[model samples]
Target: MNAFWNRWRKQLAWESVPAGTVEGRADRDPAVGPALTDELERVLTPVMRPCAGIALAGAAESPIHSFLTGHPYLPAGTTWPEGAAGPQIFVGQINFAEVASVGALPGFPRTGLLQWFVDADDTYGLTFDRSAGTAGFSTRWYADPSTAAGSPQPDAPTPTDTVDDLPMEFVGPTALQFRHSISIPDWSGLPAQHRSDPIWERLAAALGERRADPEFVYEEYVRGGSSLLDQLRTASKVGGYPSFTQDDPRGTGSYPAADSGQAELIIELDSIDVGGWGDSGVAHLFGDPAALATGGLTSIRYHWDCL
Candidate 1:
């Protein structure tokens, strides 16, 4: 068995919360007490957003905490081949609705296209809300830096690891793609938030068009780059992760503003084999690496939508 998978298998059992907790938990184990429920709900409510609801199209299991909470990969004194790259865990896809109401909009509204919960105040955490969907959606988590953690081998990561660190200040564009199934919620005959607004009607029309040409949508954005990969390569090298601006003389107007800061090499998820993913502990998923090199990987195809 792969050492990475070995570690994952050990955590298969369900981690439960008590009754009346944030998520639907066991009767005996309440996740949080009533004293904190109001505060918790307040924090959680903002994450839900006013115009949209998200469904967990799928998620790849994250590396062990010991693997990421400081270290990017397995910790020291672990066991695996010196150059073994384990199965890739790609987040499958996501579905968003305008209001989760009937006749409103079947998909995300374009008026306010900002990504939800990417703001600073949102914290990183996970919850399993059955009402939301099976394999509940996640919000506000930070990026994963994998190669920095010296593991499977005793070698320490090079300085390039830190360069990719995704603090709030760094920004870059991400071209992403992914595929998965969606279970549209049962919202029937609901009124729109505002009268004379056609958001819902527009959404219905879009769905009608999508029925003929069902396809995964792709997006290009001048947003944050992959800070996770930046740190990994930097940790493996010195100075910082390999830096090279898109060497296009046809400069200024083509891309976003010139951000000379270190950026993570691009990661292209070739294809998603499965979705609606979950586990008691260990899970396995794999994909081909579209880009993994010195200048930083590019040609990424994994794109997920957020309402």
Candidate 2:
């Protein structure tokens, strides 16, 4: 790991971005964080993005950002989140203001509280149109949480209304901790244009300069990109590229062209201390970057899967 990564890796109370690769050893680090080498800048820097890595934190005393399995800081008079089967279990929430304090992503909101609830069904109600607000999942975002007040929603679901045979229990609070990092896109998350001739040509030029054959070099570059993604992508994060157990929901079929707009990963939760997706899977929430930059929340799409 580099000195810079080593320093912050020690400061954060919870997990952190990987310690960058040590020189003369194995090239094990994700070469695309805040610190970049001139060599890396030539190839991968264009796609790197600032992201906030997440971890469990101490109990929050107020309606600040938090991640909980059941207890939710819902203001009085608000209806408990519901799905088709019935009341949904409280998922987690993101305090954009809190994200700002931890790190910054250009389009991500700086102040707000976004929470979600899902059915305790076998798949957590993440069935159909992952883009559409399906009946199994729902989100509530307070653009201005300061103006909102009350206590935790006392009627949070006990999951007795679970739609599946497997039971879903209400776990206690899991506070949130964050650290700044950089993320590079998985090829699956790129639009058609980004993955086509233009990128390949760029890769060809970048690799061709160092090798004898551009064709052979391009293939090696692609494999290297995928290898790096697999290692650095297995943690909880917000506002960065995503790592999926199956495939990216916003892959080529979902995002055919660049003009159709780029796909943005809003939040991703690995099967960690808070909850599990299935058999050691991950949860993903995607949105439109332009919408989020302006503080829009309606673009959310939810999906989860396991290996």
Candidate 3:
């Protein structure tokens, strides 16, 4: 990890997004409170969205502004290997959810919690259960590849057919405008295990370039009752009443909100010629380097949502 990533990682907290809970919604019925189902569904919906996105400039009816959703899951044994190499393992799916006491805003009688992107890099699988009392979260990260010759880890249960039933929705231009959050799981954090993986360097450099773009900005919002606040209030409320407590807000928000400071991160390879990687024109950094250093074919642009 680089300085920037290391610094942020230190501040990182691993909070489980309830798969199904009332507390995860921005607006909730204070009497009955938030339900676990509502919160979990919201998080899983976006996880189903493919990794790829396209921005075309235009109005709702304009076809140019449409986005092309990418594939949701890589086949169990599939790999993005650029050359003749072993297939990257398909671990498991990640789940997330959030909710608030009321609506997200001050004066509103609701607990507020913005949906910050969950740390998807954890090797453990997640299972969240929340009720009237407190929240109960469980995780089981798999270490060995699914195709490994030996038996799978005892802690890691053999994924069942039910895994396919898990909801993963596609967020097109329309979905982007809604109040939603996303969890990007399956990120390979170890360089030794993934040094040969070309996509890792390509993605890191791509995100770095995006972080460097002038138009690119990190955005967030304050969910006020009827009026918007200049300063963000980390409370959830509907009609000027806090529903959920700060220690336990109902709905959670992401740092780079879709329309706000968020810019779609795109990874494109010019070509994947078989023997073209060894001495590519540029030497790609595999292990770790400054995440801010500007180099490589990676590029970033602002307003891609409107593109």
Candidate 2, backbone clash total:
0
Each model's TM-score?
0.17, 0.68, 0.16
Put down candidate 2 lDDT per residue, 234-306, tens digits, no spaces: 3678877777778655544333232344456778887764456777688877777667656665666677778
Q: Which parts of model 3 are misplaced by more than 4 Å?
A: 1-222, 229-307
Q: How close is candidate 2 to the true structure, as a TM-score?
A: 0.68
User: 192, model 1: CA deviation in Å?
Assistant: 22
In model 1, which range of ten residues has the least summed lDDT? 214-223
Badly placed stretches (over 4 Å) of model 2 are: 1-36, 129-133, 153-170, 187-234, 251-262, 272-275, 293-295
Best by TM-score: 2
Give the local distance difference test score of model 1: 0.20
Q: Model 3, 1-307: lDDT tens per residue?
A: 1332233223221122232332222322222112222322233234222221112222232211111122112224332222111111121121111112111321111211111111121211221333211111111212221223322233332222222221112222221111212212222212233324343233223223233221121111112222112122212111111111112112222113222312122211111211111122100101101111212112111110000
Each model's lDDT: 0.20, 0.59, 0.20
* lDDT, candidate 3, at 53: 16
